[model samples]
Target: MIDYIMQYQSEIWQAIGETFVMVAISIVAAILVGLPVGTVLFLCRKGQLYENRVVFGTLNIVVNVVRSFPFLLLVVFLIPFTRFVVGTALGTLAASIPLAVMAIAYYSRLVEQSLLEVPRGVIEAATSMGASTIQLITKFLYVEARSGLMLGMTTSTISFISYSTVMGIVGGGGIGDFAIRYGYQRFETELMVVTIIIMIILVQTIQYTGSLISRMLDKR
Candidate 1:
């Protein structure tokens, strides 16, 4: 184990950093874009306080289109745009564009769903108290659904990590890149075992931490 780490220490560390960068950038971007999109969807959705057929229909279609594309296909289709934006369609940042794109779509729908679950009565009560649109949203929508939103975001985060392994196929370096290049391709089952174990451990840690934080924040 030490020998493997020693031989590839620098590379492994580099991959770890790249993976972290990918996940962080993706999460932040997703939240920023998804929040408003989801909030709008919730407001405009049928029977909501601010219901609008046009806005809701457009958002629903766009989000559906995004989610319809399989991740690998999305990555391939994004190459042209990725190259245009990043000057190369391979590497950490480039790989993350698709991941972030996917995250926004995936998370926006989840957010909409979460906000929808915040009872109509609660929103109506807030408005009866003369809450402004913003006030109602901040107070009623977010406050009521905070725990569910956290869990959904946590699920998205863990999911992206697993999906990121596919990026390694396109030369986006990470433990996935390492595992695929050295372990799978070269038929090093032991190396593959090590890498898979590490990924499992990482996911479990994230899940536990997220659940704890969600519980801590849950007033209900």
Candidate 2:
């Protein structure tokens, strides 16, 4: 183990860095897009703030369709689109397009579910106080759902980390790619074990930190 680490320390670190970069970009993009998409979904639901059957139904269907695709297939299917957007579909940057897109759909649903946890009475009270749409969402809904939102973000982040690993199959650079190339392909069991250990550590750390924050933020 020590010898292996000494030999490939640089490569392992580079792969870790690349994985972080991809996950960071994808998560940030997903949050930016998913937050609004989810907010709109929450508002437009039947009998909610901006209730509109046509809009709500349309958005709901779209979200479901996208969410239904298997992550691997999604990556393969989006190759052309990813290529168009990023100018290539076989690297870290190009990989992020599909990762972000998938994360958006996944996280949007999480956001919607989190928002739904907010009490209707609170919304009604806010409405009765003449809270405008923006005011209601910003002040009441978001404030009430902040903890859940954080938890949702945490869950999405962890999930995307796992999904990002699959990017390695298509030349996306990351620890997963490193594991595949040197560990599995080259029959280097020690390298595979080390990468797996690193991944486990990364996931556990994120999960613990997320849970801590969620607990701290929970006013209830």
lDDT of 1: 0.86
lDDT of 2 at 185: 95
User: In model 1, which range of ten residues has the least summed lDDT?
Assistant: 1-10
lDDT of 2 by residue, 74-129 (tens): 99999999989988888888888888988888888889999999999999999899
Error of 2 at 65 (Å): 1.3
Per-residue CA lDDT of candidate 1, range 19-95, in tens? 78888877997789987899999999888888899999999999999899989999999999999989999888899
Error of 1 at 109 (Å): 1.0
Judged by lDDT against the true structure, how good is candidate 2?
Answer: 0.89
State the displacement of the C-alpha of residue 121, model 2, in Å, after optimal TM-score superposition. 1.5
Clashes of each: 0, 0
Q: Candidate 1: where is the Cα deviation over 4 Å? A: none
Superposed model 2: Cα runs more than 4 Å off? none
* Residue 76 lDDT (model 1): 97
